[model samples]
Target: MPQDGPQPVERELPTDEARDLLGLVRELVQREIRPVAAEEEASCTFPRETFRLLSHSGLLGLPYAEEHGGGGQPYEVYLQVLEELAAARLTVGLGTSVHSLSCHGLAHFGSKEQRTERLPDMLGGGLLGAYCLSEPASGSDAASLRTRAVRDGEDWVLTGTKAWITHGGVADFYTVLARTGEDGPRGITAFLVPADAEGLSAAPPERKMGLNGSPTAQVHFDQVRVPDARRLGEEGQGLTVALSSLDAGRLGIAACAVGLAQAALGEALVYTAQREQFGRPLADFQGLRFTLADMGTQIEAGRALYLAAARRRDAAKPFSRQAAMAKLFCTDAAMRVTTDAVQLLGGYGYTADFPVERYLREAKVLQIVEGTNQIQRMVIARHLAGPESRS
Candidate 1:
């Protein structure tokens, strides 16, 4: 079963391959993702071309092997890509990250035959994926999700609703978590359902505070039929699948938090350098300088935390606590940094004339999604308590 506790791992700097990946990621962010980010966010546009570009760049499958048309990169490299992409555009970065998470169950748990059949399309194809686990009443308490999948001969009949789903309506496929037994965590199981399934439908996008460019909605499954082969692992393993996927997904959110924080810091730095007050630049003010310093420090710490978690994950070590720590620390740092960035920008930061406001908005969601910060703290506390807490 998926532990509600945090992942524990060590912190270390990136290696040569990680540095090289960051370089490539920086180039891609500068050349492709950055320029149109604001416009896309304003219009809530899903960049189909951008996804194609990323796929062509071998980013869509960064953590997978090349035999499946992937980049054959490590989690560290893949996360650097995510960080740069998020720094450029939170929407696109998040979409890509979530797509990667959606693929986790199938990639790590699927049989070789299943991987052969579906991975290529997922890794190289234009279609994106959505992970369906959180229902209206089951946000942080995912084990209580009411969605159900019942055996129907050779297929399974799934019925329930998943709420606050990123790419809910737009995804080509969904990795759904549904109950298959009496109740609780072990009763659940994971399944891959096509978007075109007969009884699957998505509600109109939710009106959200940020990430407007990425559609968030509720997906309804009314007798949606999926083949037995679509099951990700053995029966009664849905919570485990969900938690395993979340360990990876938490890292994605951490990367996003750092990226958002970096963008805010970058904007604040530019504005402080250029905008003059009292015959001097804002950088001359010790108050503003200290704020910038704090932001930078927090961001660096967050980055360090995330990198450590990534390395532990890549090493196949126990990293659940580390992942939770990264998610919590980075997201909280983003909220602080972005808020400070706005303060550094003065009134301009509050307006649409600048991107700081947008970063602040984007930062807010980072705390709420992928298990809220409250949940993260709970996980961390549990991990800190050790095995005795399990008793």
Candidate 2:
């Protein structure tokens, strides 16, 4: 998902088409999404229709191939779109990232036939998706997930619970991870599961701090049967698929974090300039201006960090470590910047009267999702110092 703050400097797009696409996105956000962001979020309402509208606009499939009904944009372009969405609302931004993550396994690892069969609908068919890997007992240690998917003739029987699921109850489909063999990472396999499959159900959405417009819940698969054709990749290749999805998903989160920070900074700049104190605008004060400067610097650094990683990804280079670093740096920067945004607004930021309060709350979760910042550090350390010492 995305972050908030600061005015977006002019972006450097590679082509006129890319610039036009961004222009459309900005117009859509300004007219449809941003106006209702606060009200819907305060009501904890999921904007299903808005997502459907996004699907119809081809905004949901920007990063996939054009042949499959996708927009075929590079990660560089796709990510800036995410940044713009996040600046409008974190729920919409993170939802877009998670939707892309849900499609990753099938897009990258499915057979040619599977790609031809599934990609079109998944990319632009007005369907929302969720990625299922984390369970109540297994979060960071996804290798130990207990979800089971036993082969049953032409189908597979899935049974388990997935925790912290975004769009858990309302997703049209799920890219699920389940055990199909011996325990540990090797046993896991990815499966495409229809949301309405028999025995599939969702727990109530969790009470969360921010992005209340996005629902998070637990999903249960009780002997849910999926066809063999739905399996993604080889039987034991699920971990590969999962990790690869996360590698890309981490970059999405980084972009969202920067966006959220930028949004928060924008709000702060407006407030400080209009707010009067000591017979002068708050912007005229050195202390708050220095704070604003630091906030702007953090937002820019985070944007640069995520964009650098996006470039590596677009170039087909090995970028997991850089992705991890970007995820870590951008999210941490979001946490700091958004918090400062609230502080800059003083007591008003502490209440629902201002959106900066919401930005701060949303920023906390970025440090946790798509792998915690701690996990990102470990991933980066592994790339640098070699894998963790087992002793």
Candidate 3:
């Protein structure tokens, strides 16, 4: 594969319209996203304008209902588009995924009136969003979150800090999960808190090892009041909403992992082909050739895994297990493939001159985000052997 930039992804689109959509996305990636990705990411600059451009292009809401101003694309189509964007830049790809996850509560469970009132602006109205579930102490055990949302007459007063929140300081809206009852799972409730809500604030962005172009920070809701109309689903059903959103979000993460691996492999292939070792090109050596082959194989495998899960979702099947499997396997594959990429590039790969090193750093986060790979394994095991037995 040529590595001037992102190579064309071999997609299996279902229709001419889907094909056209992919074409449009690729053109946008080339023209708007790729050129500035390295510079912006290096400077740790969040590209809010790029998100706006995607919103205007109807990309931010691709997998939701068109009646609510989404693109109405299937998960399969939407995910391939994600893979393409991630190959160009992870900040935009993963940011769009978080936005989609934040929209899930309202899109799937909000009252019809609420949908009519807010879905339009949210789906494509140039609004950025963040999903708040991880608390400082409750990263993997999300049910243990300490954020509280107590009812005061008609409004719910929220008070707590959400940790590791993507788009934290910049989001126009936040999908917050907070405690409303007793401890454990049933205590949580989901609410859509506008960024301008009283007492809502964000701490400075975290100094992350990668994806600095996408801000991750702690969002503080200090007695923030949310109207009852903003509540999503039934009371004490927030964990369900959060888990369901994560099921889909995991697939998005899987696709992005595959894309990153593909980018790394492409870079490795290009570099090996040009670099001379002894009397021959590095690619001519059997040992290095095997590494390249393994990387390519893993990337293709990851792509297939995520696409299979996406197809099951589009078909309205029970795909939670498949989604977990995809997330776990694809991200692990990405870590392996990206590491091999760095090895193949030798000393230059260790440097920031090439994108492979960045890919390696970025790939590490994918294994942790959405849900840790360990959590994904637990999810898959639960689907197989049933929920864990608590003492």
Summarize candidate 3's per-residue lDDT along 33-82 as a digit string, tens digits.
98888889999999999999999889999998889999999999999999
The positional error of residue 337 in candidate 2, measured at the CA in angstroms, is 0.7
Q: In candidate 1, list every pair of residues with a backbone clash.
A: 6-320, 6-321, 7-319, 7-320, 7-321, 7-322, 8-321, 8-322
Q: What is every candidate's alpha-carbon RMSD to the true fold?
A: 6.1, 2.3, 1.3
TM-score of each: 0.94, 0.98, 0.98
How far does residue 23 in candidate 3 sit from its true spot (Å)? 0.8
Ranking by TM-score: 3, 2, 1
lDDT of each: 0.86, 0.92, 0.92
Please give, for residues 1-391, the per-residue lDDT of candidate 2 as tens digits.
1223345557888889999999999889888888889899999999999888888899888999998889999998999999999989989999999999999998999998998999888889999999999999999999999999999999999999999999999999999999999998899899999999999999999999888999999999999999999999999999999999999999999999988998998999989988999999999999999999999898888888888888998999999999999999999999999899889889988988788999999999999999999999999999999977689
Better of 1 and 2 by lDDT: 2
Candidate rank order under lDDT: 3, 2, 1
Worst 10 residues of 3 by lDDT: 1-10
Native-vs-model 1 lDDT?
A: 0.86
Name the TM-score of candidate 1. Answer: 0.94
Shift of residue 358 alpha carbon in model 2, Å: 0.6
- Model 1, poorest ten-residue lDDT window? 1-10
